[model samples]
Target: MTQPYEVFVQWKRGGAHEHAVTVTASDREMALTLAKRNVDVRGAPVSIWVTPRSEIAQTSADDPTLAPSIEREYRNVSWYARERQ
Candidate 1:
């Protein structure tokens, strides 16, 4: 059965990989080949990575429980203003 794969590409040596696209394939090898042909058409990628979509875990940004309950002004830069003489 085919599986969904997330494609990531590094445009330069030693650069962080960025999400390029998604491809469906029966296995990892075919996923890589398909991603290369489809997403890297310009030959800009220095490296490529294909990961199974099922393997990734993510949290929702809108989750209210993830936010801090108390005020924390120290975390913001505006809290550190200089005092006028």
Candidate 2:
């Protein structure tokens, strides 16, 4: 069967792989199974994402296409914010 889609995984709480990437699978069920297999191989995972390639929309490859001029201040947490006040 043709590869149906891509899978994104959240391996653990507070862990970072940054963001999405491509993976191939026959269907969502198979993709989830593959994700579990990958987690078994890695020995950890908190969540998984199985999205069809046809279902995804993304920017095309080009200079400044992925440029990050704007800061995502919300993505950061200061030490003070992490502590109980």
Candidate 3:
């Protein structure tokens, strides 16, 4: 039976792998093959990743533990651009 696989590609070295597309295949090898054919058709990515969709982990959107560790009011661009008192 075919299963869904997630495809990721890194366009350049030291870059992050970005989600490319999903492919359905019978096994890992076929998934990789299809990912290459579809994702690497251009200049070729620095790397390609094919992972079974079921194996990837996801976090709850509202998880409190995942919140930022500290307030960062100064990091906002408006904070610097606002009218100075």
Clashing residue pairs in all predictions, respectively, total 0, 0, 0
2 or 3, greater by TM-score: 3
lDDT of 1 by residue, 1-85 (tens): 9999999999889999999999999999999999998876767788899999999998888887777889977676776663222
Q: Give a tens-digit lDDT track for model 3, residues 4-85.
A: 9999999999999999999999998999889988876666888888899999999998987876779976777878877454
Error of 1 at 55 (Å): 0.3
Q: How well does each candidate superpose onto the true structure, as a TM-score?
A: 0.76, 0.54, 0.69
Error of 1 at 12 (Å): 1.1
**What is the Cα-based TM-score of model 1?**
0.76
Clashing pairs in 2: none
Write down the worst ten-residue block by lDDT for model 1: 76-85
Model 2 residue 15 lDDT score: 72
User: Which order, best to worst by TM-score?
Assistant: 1, 3, 2
lDDT of 2 by residue, 11-56 (tens): 6786754334455677788777766675556556677777787887
Q: 1 or 3: which has the higher TM-score?
A: 1
Per-residue error (Å), model 3, residue 33: 1.0
